[model samples]
Structure formats: C-alpha cells, structure tokens
Target: MVTTGDAAPDFTAPLANGDIEAFTLSDRLDDEAPVVLAFFPGAFTSVCTSEMCAFQDRLAAFNDLDATVYGVSRDSPFTLNEFREQNDLEFGLLSDYNKEVTDDYGIAMDFADLGVHGVSKRSVFVVDGDGRIAYSWVSDDPGVEPDYDEIEAAVEDLS
Candidate 1:
C-alpha cells in the first residue's frame, strides 16, 4: 500500500452514485480538499459495512477538516449502489472491478483462501492537494479498522 509522503497514484473508477460516471482521484485532490481514499475489500460484508459507516458517521468532521471521503471496492458499481443506499452512505463508493486502482495504490491482495481474488486490502490514504499521501494506513487483517482520529488529525494538519 502507499505510504506517507509518497505520490498518490491516480486513476478513475466507476462511481456508485448512480450517475454512470467515473471519479478521478486527481480531480478530487484538485478541489483543494484532502482526499480520504479508502479501499475496502468488498461491500455488504460486516466488517466492510462498519468501516464505511464509520466514515459516513464522521463525514461532517472530515468535511470540517477540508477532506472528502471516497470508499473503493472491487464490487461493481451496481452492487455498490445498493450497498450505499442500504447503509445510508452519503459519500461515493468507487468501483474498481478490475482492481486497477487498488493495484496502482499497491493495496491489491490475493484472497484465494477467502474465495476472492485481487480484492483490495483494507487501506486508507489521505492525499493532499499536491497528490502526496499525507497519511496512510493499510490493515493486513480485514477485520481491523483504521484509527479515525489519526486520519482526521492528519488532514486537519494539512493546513
């Protein structure tokens, strides 16, 4: 996975916002808001749900820190669309079906044991406007969640 101070890899992926449009990582960073790019393994799973919802729950705080959240998964946009609605997720859930984005970010993992291939590792990256990763946390265990406070403080420190 990407590490702090590394240049964040750029890619576009289908959005789960029902618009049939793609989300470009660099574009979000250009908005002058630090981008909180989160890569979860899949949608609709218990651990994934809690992770996404935790971001949703603290979205306002992230916004307050001048950050925007985006959750990436290997699931299709169709699947993520429903997952977002079902969980009341207000942020965008990106579709990295081919795992290109995940791979570019160096977070792709072989989960053959779990019956999933090329799934993304549960990772979080805080990218500043310059496209540099200000903070990064990649969990080796799917059940582990990143420290939300540290993520928030990292972005807040960007100013």
Candidate 2:
C-alpha cells in the first residue's frame, strides 16, 4: 500500500452524479489544497453511512482547512448516487466499481468470509498538494470507521 511521504497513486473514475468524468490525486490536491480520500467497504451499510454522515456534518470544518473530501468504494455509480442522496453527503462519492483504483492503492480485500469480490478495505488517505500521502489510516476490522480526528489534524498541518 502507498505510505506517508510517498506519491499517491493517481486514477480517474466516474462520479456518482452521472458525470462520466475523472479525478486524480494531483487534480484534487492542486493550489496547496489537501485531499481527504476515504474508502469504505460498501454503500448503504450502517457503519459507512454513519462515517459519511459524520463527514457531512463536519463539512464546514473540512472546507475551512481547504481540503476536498472524496469518499470512494467499489460500489457502482447508481448505488453511490443513492447513498449520497440518502445521506445528504456534500462531497463527491467516487465509484471505483472496477476496483482499478482500489487495486492501485493496494486496499482491495480478499473477502474470505463473505464470498464477495472486489471489495475495498475501509481506509483513508490524506494527500497534500504535491500528490504525496501526508497521512493514512486503515481500519483493522473492515466494519470499523476511520479516525476523523487524526485525519483532520493532518489536514490542519498541511493548511
């Protein structure tokens, strides 16, 4: 997996808003702005919803730090759209449905227990303007959420 001070792997994927577009780590971290990339196991799960809702609730603070937040998962665009609307998420929820980005970041899980395929582990990465990973956190258990405080602190340092 990509580590701190290493260049963040860049990829382009479709967004949940039916926009057939793409975004890269460099594109997001332009102009000295930081990018908060959160990866969840799936959409519509209880823990994922709660984690995203918490980010939505704290949107202002993240903006105050000049950070762009992105929630990524292996969920399809359709599912991502529903998840965004249902949770009132203010940030972009990227559809890594193909697992291209997930695999590039080395976060894809084996799914030994669930018989699922192409699922991303719950993880987060904070990339600085230079496209280097400033901070990262991955949940030991896929069901757990990331440490928002630590993420916020990392963003603050960059700001």
Candidate 3:
C-alpha cells in the first residue's frame, strides 16, 4: 500500500466525469495541485453515498486549498455516471474496472463474506504536487469514513 512520503503510483484510467474520457494521473499531477483520491467500495450504497456527498459539500474548501478531488472505485464508468448524476457530484470518478489500480494501491478487498468480491476497500490518498503521498487513510472496516477535516488540514498544510 502507498503511504505518506512514498511516490504515488501513476496510472491512466477512464473517468466517469460525464465525458467518459481518459485521465492520466501523472499528467494531472503536472499542474502542481494536490489531488485527493477517495476510494470507495461501491456506488449508491448508503455509507458511500454520504461519504461522497460530504466531499461534494466540502468541494469549496477543497477548491480553496487548490486541490483536485476525484472519487475512485472498482465500479464501472457506467455505474459511476448514474451515481454522479444522482448525487449532483461535480467531481469526477475514476473507473478501476479491472481492479488493477486498486490492487496496485493495495486497497482491493475480497468481499466474498458479503457475496461480493474484488471491491475496493474504503481508503483515501492525498498526493501532493510532487506526486508523493502527503497523507493516507485506509479503513479496515468499510463502514468507517475518513476524517474530512484532517484531509483538509493536510491540503491546507501544502499551501
């Protein structure tokens, strides 16, 4: 798993940002803005919904910190499209459909106990302008969400 001070692994994934375009992680980091990558288990679930909407609610603060926020999940770009539209999510969601990105970050989970598999574990990574991880949060229990204020503080410190 990537941790604070480690260089975040770069990958190119298709975005669910309504345009369904490809976004290269390294390319975005070139802008010298901290990127907040929120990895959720699934779309439309209650907890995931609240967590994503919270980000949406705090979008201004993220913008004020000159950070870019993007939700990442194993869900397909198609599902994310509906979720984004339903929640009025302004930020994009990266589709890790193949689970390669999730696995590389060491956040992939086997949810067979819940009749699901190959889902992303709830986690967050703050990659600074230099493409090094500034903060990392991984939840053992998927029900738990990261502390938004702490994430904001991390970004605030980058300034």
Candidate 4:
C-alpha cells in the first residue's frame, strides 16, 4: 500500500454532480491546500453514511484547515448523485465504478466468499501540497469508523 511521503496516484472519474471529471492529487495538493480523500466500502451503507455525514457536520473545520474533502466509493455516478442529494453533501463524491482508482490507491477489497462486491475498504488519506501523502488510515474491519481526530491533527500540522 502507498504510505506517507509517497506521491499519491492521479486519476479521473465521474463526480456525483453529473460531471465526468478528472482529478489529480497534484491539482488538489497545489496552492498548499491539503486534501482529505476518504474511501468508503460502498454507497447507501450505514457506516458509510455515518462517516460522510460526520464530515459534512465538520465541513467548517475542514475548510478552516484549507482542506478539500472528497468521498470516494465504487458506486456508480447515478448512485453517488442520489447519495449526495439525500445527504445534502456539499463536497465532491467521486464514483470509482471501474475500481481503477481504488486499485491504484491500493484500497480495493475482495469479498467474493461473502458475495460482496470488490470495493474499496474504508480508508482515509491526507495528501499535502506537492502530492505527498502526509497521513493515512485504513480500517482494520470494513465496518469500523476511522480516527477523525488523527486526521484533524494531520491537517492542523499542515497549517
């Protein structure tokens, strides 16, 4: 898996806002702005909703740190649109339907035995300016929440 101080891989995907957009780590990390790339197992799931809503509630804090928050999942763009609207999300929710971005970021999980789709494990990566991953957290279980305090501290440190 990619670790701290490593250049974050760049990719393009469809955004929930109905735009086929391309995003790169460097673009987000430019201008000394930090990026919070949060990967969820899937859309419309309990844990995923909680995680995203928590981010929404704390959007001001993240903005104060000059961080761009992006919620990523293997769901399709159409599903992402519904999720964003239903939750009233203000930030970008990216659709990694092909799993290429997830695989490139080394977050994809295999749950064939349980009949689960190959999806990204719940994880968070903080990329600093210059596209270096400054912080990363991967949930041991797909069901657990990430350490938000640690992520906040990481963004604070960048500031």
For residues 78-115, could you state the per-residue lDDT of candidate 1 as single tens digits? 99999999999998889999889988888878778777
Off by over 4 Å in 4: 18-20
Q: Per-residue lDDT of 52-135 in model 2, one digit per residue for the tens?
A: 898888789899998988889998888898888888887888999889988998888867787897688889999888888999
In model 3, the Cα lDDT at residue 134 comes to 96
The alpha-carbon RMSD values of the candidates against the true structure, listed in the order shown, are 1.1, 1.6, 0.9, 1.6
lDDT for each candidate structure: 0.89, 0.84, 0.93, 0.85
lDDT of 3 by residue, 3-38 (tens): 899999999999999879998889998683699999
**Which number leads on lDDT?**
3
Superposed Cα RMSD, model 4: 1.6
Q: What is the Cα-based TM-score of model 4?
A: 0.92
Rank candidates by lDDT, best first: 3, 1, 4, 2
lDDT of 3 at 67: 95
Regions of candidate 1 where Cα sits further than 4 Å from its true position? none
Candidate 2 vs 3: which has more lDDT: 3
